[model samples]
Target: MKPTDYINEWVNRITPYSPGKTIDGMTKLASNENSYGPSPKVIAGLREKIPEVFRYPHKNLHVKEKLSEYCRVKPENIVLSNGSDEMIELIIKAFKGPIASIYPSFVSYPIYAQIYNREYISSSLNQDFSFDHRKFIKDAWKANLMFLCSPNNPTGKVIDVADIEEVAQTGKIVVVDEAYFEFYGTTAKHLLLQYPNVIIMRTMAKAFGLAGLRMGYAIADPELAEALKKVRGPFTTNYLAQEATILALKDLDYMKKSVSRIITDRKAIEKRLAEKYKITPSYTNFILADVSPMSSKEFFDRMLEQKIVVRPQPKFNGFEGNYVRITVGTSEENFLLLDALSKV
Candidate 1:
């Protein structure tokens, strides 16, 4: 009669996600967070809403309305979640059949699939880490739900809209994670109009700099949106998050300015890193470097010695050689990162 004996066998198979490490006084470029931080208006709004914590969060109609206006979709076509992570799980819960995605993209697609005991399938990215839509479609033929990340995590490469439309043609539920859409202005939202099964997941964590608030949303056809709403918890998004997100949406200029800065810094880092390592072209706030001569672990350790933190990509299905993901930080932080790399 051990508690372990009662745990589901499938749940036991899952390897938990390991987040980026945090250490005092280190320049953190491991996690892809917006180092610029959230807008002052959002902070003020959160302060005003603090006294109302005694009350339960409402149905989130206002938040959805505001998001709808921002996304240019009807309120009924939107569903709010604690973060896009929750939305991924909700999509798993609300759908049936195997989950499919590109190998070595977002780790959560397969992680959540395992949590729910759904079959998971994947297609390998090309040697250069570029996606091959035709190959993926054929490989994922058995999947009924597919997840695609644009300006994909770690690599920061974007999936072209034409490729996404090719996947959507299969009539499977297609979820395009646009977490870094602000950095790369291209969007697959136009596909949503033609394909009722297409869903676009977004978050305020990046350009809006509200990673602490964990606010995210999805835009799909009204019927599909309603289904997701039913599967999610009633109060997953709290009042503070709602208020803060509303304010963030209203302050688009602030978000754009931050994105512009990150984009500029991202290019600078890419240019500098390319002088040494093989740099992956990025459309997001991070760059993935092929530190081939040195093991990723060794590179991480060297960066650590310099009081800098960078993410070492674990061996995923299609990844070869050693690679590290470096988030674009503030100008000072980037300078420090470059200086540290010089020493390494």
Candidate 2:
């Protein structure tokens, strides 16, 4: 008779994804967002599109065309979504089979798989968080869908392209989440041509500084792209998001400049943090450091007392010791963070 009884048993067992917390006046470096923000042109353009909100969003043709050029794929090979998160869900919904990914990678891969009631499998990363392709391939052999994150979340480590190729050889639907590709400057796009089963997911949230607009896309073979379009809800991407993405794509230079700055700051933070903590080399705008000797929660709480926020990675599978993932903020914010770390 209870509403809970109506839910499937599998759905009841799922643990939802937890995002970083924010407090007023705190320097939030928890979530890996572009702190530099979007380009001036995108802001100006979005203001112009406000009055047009009365109308339904048009088909994603213009955005798709621009992204096609940006990604060097045909327009038909692209599918737009609310964000890359939705694209992940769509892929899970459209495909049927066990979902697999490496442990300590993107949390969404397994989380989404559970939401859709699909079997989720995972392989553990090496002690240093380095991925072993052969081990992953063997473990994920039974999976029909595989998700891989390069410049992986939390750790900011990139998967080698050769390892990606070896996984794609398994012939499963390989999803390469390149959400932070702009910072890393490499992609698995080359495999898309050779392997029709490959899907490359990207987002405007990171380097583009359009996290508020929630725009993401995927590039796949035209047939697979069409299938994803069928599964995704129509009008999921709104007018403002579409227009903002188009504007962001046009101002590639601004994004590149922001990325250059973040990368610089990322290195500075890594160098400083390495003096104490064991810092992992990063290709993205964030750094993961082993805060051993202090529990991750204790470190997080100490940062909190200073009104600074950073992500603790205790819940992620394969994380051996106390670790925290710090997003690279502006110069001022980074200075504040370092000052707080020293005092803590």
Candidate 3:
């Protein structure tokens, strides 16, 4: 038999995640990447540290220490990864005995569960895409790990604090993915003090503008953090990425400016889309537009023709229907997307 026969059933059963396209020869608004680049200090730090890459990363101090100081968590409470994507994998690998996250949150959550051969129990969102914790809590005891993405992807909505606390009280490990936290200005990091089962993940990809560097981390209780560490491969984060992240954190002013711009631009985009296209508002760095006027595939093709790329969320096999997720971009790029939409 061929090697394909040897593959695990779950591996064969899994559907690969379709991410936002990179802007190779076009302006990309498909991924919610920061329009502004990373901090100036980050570039300078990388340049200064280039010579040290000849040696293996120290892996014990500096980067973690800086992160600890910035996040106000103990150094032992942190686990570094190539990106928050790896942390999602680690959580599933470490604690997923049966089930994982509900549906329509991060697409990767279910993918991670499938990779671990766990049964994914997907709870759907309401008509408005806001999470209903009551439904998830009712089924919580069945899962050892539960993934919650605040300011959830695609829908760009968040779960309230009270709802998150109730889920955390269920005694299951809760992985709160705060990938879009900077744009929304809310987080469950504070809840960790009361719930040892809670783990908050943050990424440098979105607001921090380090998507290329692949730096992400998790903040959790010391014991749970150690459990995740056991599953993570050594040196998942490289020496340059670590050093660049340190500088990313050091230049607080630069990060603040970028976040401020996103917040402002997000509001403007919503206001204009509402007035012009009659579209609804989104809470995260990206917005989901109802594509009922045209087929999602057709609309996506039109956008591409205008040299713009956006993600079309396929409404197939129990997934939401007729919607596309558009990332918030720079003022000029955002206008270009609007211009394309107006024409179509």
Candidate 4:
């Protein structure tokens, strides 16, 4: 074995998450990111906080207080992280067992399992790509961690609250990622009151448009929340992010306007794309379409040729190479992609 063979067997097996490819002057719609920016208040918040950057932000009690009020969970029941991704990693470390998630969902769930050298388990989605809890109910009992993405990535299907409760009943710690919660208009956070075992993961990326700031958090049983803090260590949430998110949460109007545009545009794109291809109606800010006239790879290349970037879901678990996920962008950006698809 070579010197690098010192790596753990699981680490050796993991394929790291690939970000959407970047190209100069391209209309990007691959990462499911909100094309809108954070509240204008964030700019002022940053300017006010920049002078204090030299000081380490002590535990962010004030920010947690704001999040608690927003999520309607007690402050002690929350654990803040750099992003929802960090919260997932912390959950893996704290739970320290096999990671299970619905397949062709978020690719990162299995990737997180590999990074921590934990077992990764999954069950395929229905042929329509919608979730069905009955398929994995038995396997869930065997798992220590369960990552459920509501308004699921790529597919944009939001698992029903009843479906989430069924998985929570299996006794595994259920982490419901609500990264696109604002778009969907439903939350499993109510499950927290019913199930002590549930963990609702949230981020400021999608609706709040704070992806660059890396602010995400979780709401869980107070005991589990405390455990996450121990695993998360210290200072992962830097000063600017903590303050900016607090401000962003206060400006609900900005989020509403941003989400409104995406939802409106999502329907518009779905309507247009449906005329030519099979497209999934979505709750999140993206649409998954079957691009059967061309291989996903060919379609991706075709879009790139038009200076647009879209995600081909075949790279994700359970996809069979005829699907692509297109993010809902600004009107002009969406028009560019739609126009390109018409020609391609």
Candidate 5:
């Protein structure tokens, strides 16, 4: 039999989730990465900590300590990982739950759910691509684990706190993925005091400008937080990534400045696009644009030819047809994207 036939059923059945292109050879606005590189101090910190790479990393040390202080939570309440990607995978392995998430969410949830052979349920977003809390809560109650993205990926719509609280009351473990939190200026950290079952996941990749470092964290009650320790790969985080994150935390001012720029540019892009393209108000660093004039395939092809990459919404059940997710990029890059859109 072919190697494909011998592959695990779930693995063979899975359709890989597509990610945005690398910026190396293109005007990359496809992946929603912070255009501003890692905090300047992070570069300096990595140089200073280069020697730490020779020895095995200390189990619990400065990075976790500094992160806890920054997050205003106890060190015990945080579990750092290679990046938020590892955190998501850990959540799937640690919890035996019927996985549920709102549609047009971070693509990884369904990927991980299938990997674990768990029941994965999905609810659709509203027509405007905003989350409908009533449907979310209704579906969440039946799930053991639910992934909710704030300033939701691709769509860029944020759910109100009142609705988030209502869903938290569903009494299941609610994993809120705030990958784009800094861009939006909203958070679910306050909900942690009231909901013990809530796990707030934040990525250094998007807002902190540390996507290259691959570091992220989860905040939860210490008991529940510790449960994830089993799946956490010891030494999965490298010395450089740890050093970079600590420095990024120290340069909060620099991080905030970059975040401010992204917010400003996001609004500008939204307004310009809305004048001609069917664009929605995005609170995050990306916008979901419906290019119904062209078929989704044609839209994708045209953008690729222009060397600009954007995500196409998959036509799964309720989600159909030509919508592309455009990430906020630098002034020059955004202008390049505009130029391409103007032509198409």
Candidate 6:
């Protein structure tokens, strides 16, 4: 039999996720990575704990208690994952139901469906990239799992809590991926007390500058958190990641400053780039701009040639060849990108 016969039908049909390329000495702004470096405390903590690698991580993962303090939830109400992507996969693996999310959000949501062989569904966003709230509510009733990406990836649009609460009130499982929560400044965690169905997923990768460490966690009802733990690996969270995340969370002021700096730079870049490219108000660390007169491929190629990289938009969903997502880099890096754009 051919190799085709060995492949599972669902896995074969799903397209794999392609991450942005990394090049040495390139002014990288494509992947939405935090431009700011990690906190002093995080670096120090990681170094101090380096000698402890000979042993397995603490069995209970008491870092959950620290996370509980930061998130204002009890330890049992939280579940940690290798990264937010793993959390999404685990949820789909653990729960048995129809999964639904908005189109053009995080691309990984659909991949998990193929891996677990679960039902996956998506509702397209409006032309302006806003959700059709009425249609979403109607669909929520039928779906058992709803994956919501607030401060959505690529588009950078924020979701209203009122809209989320509407679906949560219906008893549908609403997993809000607030991976960009630091950038957005609001969360659905508050609704969890009344709505046991609300599952808020946050990551240390963005604000904490621990993307390399790969730490992400979910805040959910205590019972739901327990169920997710049953599907999670005993030590999916590494010792370094857990330790660094705790240090980062405790040094809140340091992270807050980094966040403030990125936000300031985002606005500056938007104002200058808006003269040529149409930009939406970003609630996240990246800005999506309409770069017409140049195809997405052409723009991406030109930027790469100049050693300044930005994200290219594919014509998936309703996107044409005119849009590109640019991460909000440091002021110097942003200037370098703007200068490269001028040359292109």
lDDT of 5 by residue, 152-212 (tens): 8867889887788888888788899988888877789889899998999988899888888
> Which 10-residue span in candidate 5 carries the lowest summed lDDT?
313-322
* 106: Cα error in model 6, Å: 0.4
Question: Candidate 4, clashing residue pairs?
Answer: none
What is candidate 3's lDDT per residue for 195-277, written digit by digit as tens?
99999999988988998889899999999888988998887898888888888888979988888877788787777666534
Please identify model 4 stretches exceeding 4 Å from their true place: 315-321
- Which one wins by TM-score: 2 or 3? 2
Candidate 6 lDDT over residue span 1-344, tens digit each: 99889888888778898987778999989888887878887887789889999888773456899999999999999899998989999899878768888888898888888788878788888777887778887755567898989989989998899988877877888899999999889998999989998899999989888888888999999899999999998889888888888888789998899899899989888897798888878999999988888888888999999998888988756655388899988778988987887888
The residue-by-residue lDDT of candidate 2 on 1-344, one tens digit each, is 89989999999888888898878999999989898999999999999989999999994899999999998889999999998999999999999779998888888888888898898998888888898999999899899999999989877899999999999998999999999999999999999989999999999999999888899999999999989999988789989999999998899999999999989988988999999999999999899988989989999999999999999887555456789999999888999988998888
TM-scores for all candidates: the values are: 0.98, 0.98, 0.95, 0.95, 0.93, 0.96
Off by over 4 Å in 3: 276-280, 316-321
Collision count for each candidate, in order:
0, 0, 0, 0, 0, 0
Q: Candidate 1, after superposition: displacement of residue 230 in Å?
A: 1.0
Better of 3 and 6 by lDDT: 6
Residue 336 lDDT (model 3): 88
For residue 146, what is the lDDT in candidate 6? 89
lDDT of 4 by residue, 95-137 (tens): 9577888877887788888888787888778877777888877
Query: Against the correct fold, how does model 5 do in TM-score?
Result: 0.93
Q: Is candidate 3 or candidate 6 better by TM-score?
A: 6
Better of 1 and 4 by TM-score: 1
Alpha-carbon shift of residue 91 in model 5 (angstroms): 0.9
**Could you give candidate 1's per-residue lDDT for residues 162-277 as a string of tens digits?**
99999999999999999999999989998988999899999988878888888899999988988998899878998888888888888888889889988998888899899999
- What TM-score does model 4 achieve against the real structure? 0.95
